[model samples]
Target chain A: MKSIRIVSDFNSNQLIRLWKNINNNIKFSNNDFNQVYQEFANYKNRNDITVFWTNAQRVIPSFNDLLEYKDFDENVCYDEVRNYAISLKTYHKEKSNISIVPSWHLPLDFKGIESQNWKFNYGPKFIISKMNMIMSEIFSQDENIYLIDSEIWFNDKIDLDINKLWYTVKVPYSNNIFLNSITTFNSILDGVLGKSKKIIILDLDNTLWGGIIGDDGIDGIKLGGHDYLGEAFLDFQKELKKLKRRGILLAICSKNNEKIAIDTIKNHSEMILKKDDFVTWRINWDDKATNIQSLMNEINLGLDSAVFLDDNPLERDLVKKALNEIEVPDLPLDPTNYSSFLRSLNYFESSTLTKEDFARSKMYKENIKRIESKKPNFSFDRWIKSTESKLKCIKINNSNIERAIQLFNKTNQMNLSTRRLNREEFLEWIKEKNRFVFLYSLKDRFGDLGIIGLVSLEINLKDAMIVDFILSCRAMGRNIENMILSHIRKFLIEKEKDSITAVYKKTSRNSPILDMLKKSDFEEITKYTFKRNNISIYFKSDPNIKFEEINDKN
Target chain B: MTIKQIVYKCLDEINLSLSDGDKLNKSKDELLIGDGGKLDSLALMIFLTDIEKNLKNHLNIDINVLDDKLMSNSNGPYKTIGTFIEYYEKKNEIN
Candidate 1:
């Protein structure tokens, strides 16, 4: 079973009950808010993942305490809390398998008739913002520290019965809060464990809209309007679009005539998702299972990475039976509940944002041209060269930091060490005088594939250590990896670095890069470590592709 | 609604998870809740709340099936389906 130890400030014994059927969860002492770091240190060597679940009230000064001190500076509490959080982060810097859940909720400053002091009313907001700042600071400082925001766990009012539960059970939360927060709570666990899905295989017809496009025609289909039914479908499509922008590949699999479906997607005015929005489609009369399989193969994604969503129960069952690894969620009877059901599934719950995420849809859109270019004569090498790809290698800066971190999180198949760095850790690494990071963006004849690769190296005298090397799957086969290495070699030569060393960390899904270091002209010095004695290897880009080196203006 | 109809409707809502044979012997005067209850506390709560929601939707009237008076009384209204119906009938009369 998955192992997890939770060190919480409040009495979170209910979490054990919530996750009883899931992982083996161990809860530490209650009301030991100040002893979190001590507990974390004790379990730092344990195999179980350590989670620091924080509540806003734990760090914020209680009103009772504030009243006790007549002349206290307000900044004292904020600074003290911030310093305490920073100390915890500093103690665990560069540590592995640690998760920090930042404070999300502060009891609302009730502006009732009892007291209407606007000055004191802003205390909760101040605490909330300060807690958020602490969380973000810790998140950036440590690669292993995953931040789970508490606010996303609730909506509108804080989802807690503090008064009743505090008096009776000392838990400070009701059953309703536990029930509602379960998914978000589990999503945080999933995020830390890297157990998130990558691809979404969508169904058309009743799935995306009210009716079948083949039967209703293009304009006749119901989507995006004041009508409730249409609005439900429209909202669902909007959610899918958001996921697409966040680097989830959206593919179409349906049992409709290709022409009719394509026409509807291309011409339907009410449709929120256009034809170009999808990475690929198998809009034919074939069975959905077969189509989904082909789509996964074409996208170079595994079945486990794909989520199939079809409104029809029979179709959902068919795909579920055929592809057991692919997640096929049961759609609610009513379309109005579609978006909520999908959101609750937590298929794409990621903790960090990178520029490549926002540009993912555009990158996939560029793939269509590559796929089409190989239709008549299928030659992978020829097609890749004919694209006339140009590589722009630039140092990692503010402009490309998001994409760099995106590559760190998303790139699996071509990652040398598979080391994921959080935003702050990444900034610190690139900012070091001895260490340098390069963010590579590729542009082909078709379009710009935004920031596809990242490489970080730590220089020590005449020797260099490859800290990170990752290339996105979309830009994998086009010799982009080789080009990145070539650029790195040039940099090393320019810096008068004589030798380079790299380590290959193997993961279940990263077998594609197991022998990458060996293939990249490095000799195996140890089990995972490799060394290249001479840095005089002559490097050249692909003949058909023109390469450029972009300077960081930022 | 009549006493027998109210009991039948409440049983019908809970019947989603129950087998037909299990629910066959249920009657208006059946002891379905509280001490020696056929349903557990959670199931009883769900059944009562669903009945209240369904009744409000159908009749445009709200009734608290688990009111403080019903719980605090020596022999509460929830002793049987018949008692529940009688309690609601008297409360509706007051309203």
Candidate 2:
């Protein structure tokens, strides 16, 4: 049996399951983590690996107690907990190559909402907060250190605030702890090192196809519709396209006849890729290295982010030799392994794909229209009109619950009402007689974004306070927010309310909302604070965009 | 920060280089410091003060860590890098 060791703050049933899945011979060293800590102070003696399972000094014995320290000052608690985390470093000092996986308390999606006394269900919030404090303790020397990826907290925290207690149980939309957390953890691990390349730079001719485009005259290029080697390039392009849709930038760098290559992507019906799909393109007879350098500058990305894919090893080597940053995965000898090889690529292993990832390719494609109209007299507003902005506000629903939660946790800039809601707290709000939560989705002449913003409100009949208001970063710089608030103000006027008060809480990251409030000339009662909005702000706006009220129980 | 604080930060960074088992049972006397400890010679390649700098100006000390006889004493309290720290601080005090 293969042997492994499990190190965790707590010994639990799920951990045992994970250990069994990994290896039965996995010796779990349970420790009175508290004692294991004191011993670590000496830096000489070693704790027995098998004893960590029973350590009474463990930070928390089980998952249910995630928030015993929640009401305490988060940073102060971290300041204190950081010492214990540093104490744990003694193990890493001696065992530089040991791989230890962490078991977070609750997956990110669970909200602790069973009852007022619900102690154990707080799940990922507490664990993640503490882990965040401890994680920074690591030195640059340890090579065997492993990272855990989990997003359940983000999923649960945001989704919990949406339509509340269906059956009065405060239990959230779901409790998919294992899979959600695993995927979340996977993405964050990718983010820290950023293992996934956000952009995949490709080559034309023999790289994406069987023959050079200059020789084939765009007609003879071998992109398979039904046959053998053309099929190979077809599969390769499909894989590349999938990565593009997931928000990876696709750029072409080839010494090709520009018109012919354009005809290939534009006229070739069998071509899975289109000219409009590429964020940026470099199709010139210049040296491949020069073309790639120009393309990197054009795309505003460092060469390291560009994954140069070419069939010619010499060309790949030339770019790699000249620009040390680019990742050139050596092409296989034959095209047969192309799909399998692409599957093995890990440049853009993100934890979760937000709505923004799905729309990046098209948004970049709009640059083509911009470039086509580069005359001094070309109007920017006229071009924006061609890409009509569409804002669709859908209250948080089952399908979008996961994404909404992700946005809630991840959105930093334009966040109003930044107070994170526990499952129980959210349940309390939703079940209360006077609260409502909803999310907003915006698209333009570009595409249909399913959902992109969140706004929650609480009502006491005579007064209303906004609880949560945040927008995705991709949707920033657009007036999609003003459009949504217009809807809210109208809703309040219909209810005969005197005024609609909005709260803008202060956080280090939510400064953008402050900026918006200032730009709109809203009444700032105090720093990082706001008062109610009168209906005139939305009703008196220009009629360039359509404003429609959407009311449906999600 | 004082020399004792500098010494503590340096030792903490070095102790951080070890395994969990060694870390949990780490003794004040087992800490390796300068050229006198069990850390591979490369650990000395990093100026001991460089390691202390990461502790956020929490410590400052001037000590030659690359000396050959840092931890060679068989009977003295400072036999390894870990023990050397214990002996040097035996005479110094920090509150």
Candidate 3:
């Protein structure tokens, strides 16, 4: 029974009734217009998240006034609304509250727009249009506020009586629109809560292009240029490329000859995505379901985070039957519809993108080389040494804050407590004098992996508590954790600390870190607490690899 | 299917959550709307919209339930199930 409190000007009972069907712990405020602002202002230091929902008409009762006077300068109303929104934004800027500002839906000056005297340059005919712009500005600059396209929901309005309900009862909308609003609200909530699919596992043959490359040959496949089907497929690939840039990992799973498919991906001139574009590919005559599981394990991502796309219904059905947790969308029979279908799915939705997102594919590409180098002739120690791994420990600063926040929030497998912090919360916590935030970036002979590790510590006079410890999966298997632990140990010894306590909070995906403290030589002081004496630093580095610290000059 | 069957099917599709007592037979002159109606305001809206959508999709005819001309007629077709079906049959003939 997790509860959410809502403060709204209009009646949200219909919306609440629909939301209760999905989540039943909704606490709605009384529908008094005067109390909404007070309720929002008084919602400080509360445990439950408070949401402010206001309609365009409720915000400005004189919205109809502008429609009546075609010559009305909207700035008077616009300035009033902007000031109100700014005040509300400042009130909840630091808090974890949410605001849903909807665009205006009333038909204002529609007749004017259609008339011969209409001018396109005149400030948007609808006052809600101005409000939408204001809300967009607030949403883009601020962290928590979200804008709902109230006009679209109103266009989706089916019946007229629901509009009449506004005069009769206080219901803002009818049941149909209310149901849709709940759906949109839930998606926004999911994005804010850091819950989303992480990887997209695509089938190459008919999925990426028009024909099978194994039989059709590389140049014979329909891809790019004026060919309608080929262009459609290319457009889909281009869209997926944009997603990859936004940090959604892309991998290929196809039932073709490994050498032939690899050659095609490497040298195909028409291909928008080349060999290095994919993080990993399983191009063999194996069951796709089994290959998907292998990909999941190789990437260390949950099956729930993988989206499977293929053109053949049989292959799609096979994977769906095998892995029910993976999202397998039904492909349209025509290739032209592929891009629109993918767009409509909205599978990869993230609230925020950090600096680390742009270079994620490059990092995964480096890991591919490391995986390939682990051949039978290459011993584990020999490979580690020959790669020349370097772990550069540095103090966290504004320049690398985004990546540090990303590592803390997204890394699950190698995380200690799995604690998540939003951008503002992370910034506020880092400002505390007693807190020490340590971050590091790794590089090797293969490639330079950007900032991939984070450690947040809350230190007191007697002892230090390790609040957060997380490392990107690309930086694992390199003994970087020991390097971090050793650095912290040196810092504690210099501060005259008595003991260092590290707690292991177990999550479903953090099993790798369950025995992390014990492996680092910290004695188990209690069921969850592990403590270590302030002794000399102890860590082992491979002889062949030289670990170096990067200074500000570098 | 007959008009009566289409009306019954549409009502069933729209009001799937209706209770057993509320699922009474739709006979002629039965109070179906307004103050003494079996359906509430939202239910009545859903019923009319669903009927329009189903008829257009399945039968290829677009009938307006809230037409000003129709509502202002001498006999309002929204009085009961039988009168609505009769009106629909007449409207379809003219179209």
Candidate 4:
């Protein structure tokens, strides 16, 4: 199980109350102390800032009782505290893992402006801003930290990432640091916040209007634009369209004749949503979950990320109770209040925002491009040759080891064995005198594929066990795997290590890797075990395979 | 108008007249998702949408009633028109 440490100022009771809601599995510590060193060990070992229950609870140590840099600066207590904290940090030197800033410090921006009034009895906003600044600093330093700015977390009201915003917003949080890691809660929050939902599985009849679209006929249905109830629904549809524009994949999963709903979405221009807005359309009597399943297969997103918006509470409850992971937001009784009511759903918050985030749903819209592009119009081999895809095959160096380990843990597909190794475990394995770690950075014509693949292995000089060989799904279908294996084989030939072995581990989210094994055509020693120790040193270069040098200098 | 009248009105809108016996049986937990108890999320979405419009028309009560606690409680107030009426009455009484 992945580990995270929560650092919060919640009294034991307050922490326990929210503990179950946030994470049932996370380990939490409720320690209140004036000394930084006393609270530094666990915070230094695990992931940063799990949960901080700073309900006006954080107090900066006496400004007078701190340290200075020079030795034996006995006169100034402030000097002593500062010096000691610095010494502890320097002695630890970049080992500070999970971190929290004391409430007293100002969040000094890059422009050097003090963000909040530091001298005043600053509320939770002080810590929240401090956390944001620190995260901004840490994320810049390394890519490992996926900073979810707490200010943006709860409607810009309670910046959970910042503690002082809580005092201002009156939002008390039980210190759950693993909120972003909780995918269901996060997805729901993301959905409600209008962050990322590809498919909006909607209902028919009363959902779209007052009566069933089939039973009531086109004019009979109560939609927002034309009739009284129709106006309210029109408001609802307008809100749905806004979400759709933000790259939310809209789909129809209703129990209605396809023609009527189609006519309404298509011909009904006064209607808020058009037929083209939804990437996938499923309007049949099939079970919503089954419809959802087909939609998920069609769109290729985890059900956990999709939001099912229906008018019937029963249908919502069925999906919620059945697939607890998929977010089934409670539809408000008042269609008129939907615009504001949807505002309150927690899953709508954007946790990690990158430029690529906005394009996922459009990519869903362009899934035809995604599929058709997968099969190159220029023909597979020609496309592979035309792009002149260069593979930068590099041996693991000290500077890249941490990133390599991260890729090892995170890369799902093309991961031969899915062997996840933390830094310590990886370092120990590397020092074993028999292991090799290789990271591949692929760059094609479109853009740079950043550190797309990695393979961690252990060979007894004569034979090797491929512990992990995973590549990102982004780099698939590029004949990339063929080139990666080619490099490994050539390296093995140089070392005279014969009979290389590999394993394929199965996971629910990773179906692409199964294809990787089949494509490589490995000799199956057993059901899931495959081995290929020898490749012809003179193996005819299938003109389909294009290879190039990946020297560190380049 | 009392929540009971509103509940009956809601039942009327959905075209399902709740009997006094069925009303009594309508506690929060047994509300199905799609049928009488279970509302297809679409129907629940539509049902809530219509209910809001009806509430505004008759009761003039502008309340935001669609959310996790409203529908997800094992004994959710949103479960039945009756339970919802009780919740509305209680919430208004507090207000």
Candidate 5:
């Protein structure tokens, strides 16, 4: 089981219990209070996550001097922050494990006039914000380090019940703050595990706009004019557009005439989302559940990766009953509350963004184009050759490591072993002798589908094994699967390895990998293991696709 | 609500955070903080703070449940739910 070691300045036994209530698989380990530095230096687990949290005053006692209006040296605070960052960096360099640290913030009841507190250099708020900025700048460069924004957990009212609980017990925060912080931490963990939702299936009519397009013609729909309700609907659409830019695919599942809806979306002067913004849609008079299923299939995504939004309660109920795995949030009664409600859901949390994420919706649109181009009687080879696809093999490095890790965790169907790893673990694995990871970015005449495949190999003397073979579903068809195998075989041949083997572990979603392996002429060593000798010339690079390799100086 | 009802309602709020094994009993004679108490030192503080907040919200009565009088009592008012309710009634009368 994965474990979390919490090193904090305050008592965290309660926090451990709260986390356990949320997730049972994780084992939480708490250290003594006020041992943040000691715990950071002593922690040795390379496989577990460690969290370091501290009150600024507690960690740097000199800050207390400033708090009490006594003489204080700002250099002391900077020196302490530097020392802490050094310890964190040293620990990370040695262990290469994930570490979470909450940014420093003043207590909720800290008495300071807003105008004067922020203006003075040595004010508590000023000092804490500066320290937090320095800490974030230093920690964010490390891929394995996560600096949580603690302010988001607090409100205008005091979250820390200092009068009632601070002195008697070490717990400074109220129950509500603890619960909210734990929820945010849980969602971050979900994002790290690649469990965050990817797509938003939205309904038209009352959902995206103020009225049904069937009854209210294109110009009659209330959206993006001087009207308050129309402005609210427009704001909601803008919120969705922001989410779309963050790599969450938007899809339409409306029961309306396709021409009218598409026309409205294309020509509506105030519409925030255009036709190209959506990856795919199913706008027919069919059950929303079936439409959603068809949309997911068309994009090669699972139901769990989607969140459904419908203003109609009956339609929401039907979809909920039909697909329990998909998330269908209850829309509030008022249109103005829609944007805030969607933001409150926190279903699309991501640890970081990459180039692939910025262009995800466009990539899906390109895939759909490729799908639509195929004729019913077209041969597979002829169709693939017509696309003029190119696959560029890039070595995994600091620049592209984040996307590589994302692909490793997110790709399920085309994965060989379905192994999951965080940034540090993945980097450490690749650093070992005779281990190599190569990422492949595919593009066609339609568009550039960003880095969508990852392959890692481990060599032992003359024998080599493919540790991970993951390809995004967007690049699954078009002979890329066979081309990846051929590339692996060619690389092994160049390395003078005698043979290469792949073990297909059976997962509920990984049968596609097994199917591809069986078709590639790998001799079956066991029911799950496949092997091909170096002398075997059964697999060949696809002539329809051009391949290039770029080596990195690691 | 009466003092006893307010105390029980506060306990119900605290119970939501407690595990099944650590939940506080709602009976009047149940021990709260001293010997045989369901709460540890941390839980005891949270329980008292929750009661204080709830009392102010429900009755507009500002009282510190952890005052020195209760701490100094040889047979503390926090021994059982009944004793705590009696102490709160006396404190409310003083207010």
Candidate 6:
């Protein structure tokens, strides 16, 4: 079982209870209250995730001096925060485990001089804000050290009854704040575990716009301009566009005339989402559940990766019952609340935003183009050759570590082991004797599919085992799998290894990997385990693709 | 609603946050504090704070459930759900 060691300044029993309520699989270790640095130094479990939660005044005595309106050097407070951050980073580098430090915030009702609080550097609020900024900047440099924005849990009203709770029970915040914090924490955990939703399937008629597109037509739909509902719909579309920009694939699953809907998306002045913004759409009169399944199949993504949004209750219920894996959120009755409600769900939370994430929708769109360009009678090999695909193999380093971790966790279908690891865990694993990882970025005439494959190897004596063989579904079925195996064989040969072995671990979605292994000329020594004695003769390079090896100088 | 109903409703609301095994029974005879109680010291604090907030919102009457008398009394206000309801009814009447 995965363990979480929570070390906090205040009593953390309530937080532990709430977190346990959220997830039972995790084993929690709540350290003694107000023993922040002691627990940090005492932490030895390299696999367990450590959470360092502290109240500003409790941890830093200089912060209390500032809070009391006494003369204090701001640099001292900053130095303390920096010390904590640097210590956490050093501990993380040593332990090679994840550490979460929540950004400190003053209480909502902190009574400071109203105008001077934000304007002056000496103000308590100002110092705390600056401290949080310093913490963000320093913590961001380390992948394992996560600095969560704790301020998001608070609001205009004081969430703490300082008089009753602080003195009586060492818990400062209200139960509501704790509840909200747990929810955000759960989202963060989901993001860290690579379980965040990737796609949003939207209904166009009443969902994307204010009115039904079938009956109202393009001109009659309430989209933008002076009307409140129109502006709301427009804003909602803008929110969806922003999600698309951040790599969440948008698709339409509406029962509508495809031509008319496409026309409205293209021609409508108020529509923020254009026709090309969607990677794929199933705008048909068929059952929406079937359409959604078909769209997922076409896009090569799982049903669990999608969040369906539809204003029609009947359609929502139908989709929810038919496609249980797909998350169908109940759209609010009012169109004005749609954008905020969607934002509140936090389905698209990502731990690290990479260049590939920004270009994800565009990459999928290009994949769709590649699919459409292929003739119905064209041979698979010829079609792949026609695309002029190129694979660049690069050793994993600091620059590509985040994206490498993302692919390691997200790819399921073509994965051999399906082992999930955070950046620190991965780095630590590779630091062991005779372990290496190769990341492959695929590019065709269509587009650059950024780092879609990862191959991990473990060498023992003259034999080498493929620890992890992961390829993104987007790059599959294009001779990329054959090329990856060939590349591995060549590397092992260069390393003077006698044989290369791969064991296919069976998962619900990983049958595709088994098929690839069978076709790649590996003799089945046992069930699910394949081995090749003559690595040079067994694996052949795909003539359709060109391979380049990139060395990381840094 | 009666005072008994209000207290029971608050208990039901608090049960939403509690784990399934730790959930408070709606029955008045159910133990609420000390041994055999669903709440520990921290949970009791949350329960009492929630009760005070609910009473203020629903009845517009503010009462401190954690008063000096209640803390010092051998027979505290929260011994069982029935005792808590009885104490709350008397407190509401006094208010």
Query: Highest DockQ, which number?
Result: 5
> Please, what are the lDDT tens digits per residue for candidate 6 over residues A1-554?
88887778888887787777778888888767777788668866664677778888888878888888777999898999898777767766776467778888885567777877776678787889898888888877788678888887886253554457777788877767877877877777777888899999999977899765644567888999999999999999999998998899999998665777798899998889988889989875555777787788787777889999998665676677667788999999899999999889977878888999989998987875322321223244554566678899999888999999998777766789989899889988999879999999988774687899999999999999999999875566567888888889889889888898899998755766887888778899999999999776766778878899989867
Q: Report the poorest 10 consecutive residues by lDDT, candidate 3 chain B.
A: B66-75
| Docking quality tier of model 3 | incorrect
Where does candidate 3 stray beyond 4 Å? Answer: A4-11, A23-54, A90-96, A106-111, A115-122, A139-141, A148-180, A365-554, B1-95
Task: Give the C-alpha lDDT of model 3.
Answer: 0.68
Q: Give the range of the ten consecutive residues with the poorest summed lDDT in model 5 chain A.
A: A369-378
Compared with the true structure, model 4 gives a TM-score of 0.40
| Model 5 misplaced regions, further than 4 Å | A156-158, A368-554, B1-9, B24-37, B67-95
Q: Please tell me which model should have the higher DockQ, number 1 or number 5.
A: 5
A-chain TM-score per prediction?
0.57, 0.37, 0.60, 0.44, 0.65, 0.65
- lDDT of each residue in B29-49, candidate 5, tens digit only: 888765567877677777788
- Judging by lDDT, tell me the better candidate of 2 and 4: 2
TM-score result, candidate 5: 0.67
Model 1 chain A — which ten-residue stretch has the worst lDDT?
A: A369-378
Q: Which of the numbered candidates is closest to the native, going by highest TM-score? A: 6
Cand. 6 TM to true fold: 0.69
Runs in model 2 lying further than 4 Å from the true structure:
A1-195, A217-219, A365-554, B1-95
Write candidate 4's Cα lDDT for A317-395 as tens digits. 5466556668888877777776666655554444445556567556777773322112111233544565556677777
Candidate 5, residues A97-176: lDDT per residue as tens digits? 67778888876678866676776577778898888877888887787788898888787363455556767778777777
Consecutive 10-residue window with the lowest summed lDDT within model 3 chain A: A369-378
Q: For each candidate, what TM-score against the reference? A: 0.52, 0.34, 0.58, 0.40, 0.67, 0.69
Per residue, candidate 1 scores C-alpha lDDT tens digits across B1-95 of: 65446657757645543434434246556776555566644445545655665566556566665555664453677777777777777876787
- Summed backbone clashes in each candidate are 1, 63, 0, 84, 0, 0
Chain B vs. true chain B: TM-score for each candidate? 0.74, 0.44, 0.77, 0.63, 0.84, 0.80
